[model samples]
Target: MHPAALAGATLGRLAHHAVSGLVGAALLRGASKAAPKAKPATRKAVVGGLAGGIVAARWLGSAAEEARLKAGDMLAEARSSLGEEAPPPSAVDIGGHDHDHEH
Candidate 1:
């Protein structure tokens, strides 16, 4: 086999073994716990993970919307000043209207 291919295969196997070992250790630890059978969904880790995910999603969505609005405004401004000529595709105006579209 090629040297690079051999290295990649070895790395892949090592990663797989490492991940499997970690998962097995975690599962064994959980099985060994003597705690009473509590509801799985009520775990603190699960709730915290869910809340963090929701917050991240909202933040990303708001940021994307803000960026889009800013782009639109830049396009409108460019169109107003450039006038009649077709603005470059990358151009943004002060308002978000398409330069080619009739008002």
Candidate 2:
């Protein structure tokens, strides 16, 4: 897709992985107290956490992608609406400023 989509996807995946790793590690450690071995419940918690994190991240990424696309479209529309002549930037003279201009 577009660069926005790619960037969103990449960032989302990274964030998802980081969060999932932290959560998973915490869960595993917490569960270790009850059962040192990897049990069904522990597995469930890890898998569930990972799945949830990924899904949420993907949704956020999609939303960001949509927003980017909308912003781009709006900018294009604004440019077209402005026609050939675009607005000029607002600036100050700054010629008589207090700064030392001698050199």
- Candidate 2 residue 102 Cα shift, in angstroms, is 53
Q: lDDT of each model, Cα atoms only?
A: 0.81, 0.83
Where is model 1 more than 4 Å wrong at Cα?
A: 2-19, 30-42, 85-103
lDDT of 1 by residue, 5-66 (tens): 99999999999999999999998788657334654644776899999999999999999999
Q: Write model 2 residue lDDT over 18-41, tens digit each, in one string.
A: 999999999978877778565777
Clashing pairs in 2: none
Off by over 4 Å in 2: 1-33, 36-38, 85-103
Model 2 poorest ten-residue lDDT run: 84-93
Cα TM-score of candidate 1: 0.50
Q: Which candidate should be chosen as best, given lDDT against the real structure?
A: 2
Model 1 is weakest, by summed lDDT over 10 consecutive residues, at 34-43
Considering every candidate listed, which one attains the maximal TM-score? Answer: 1
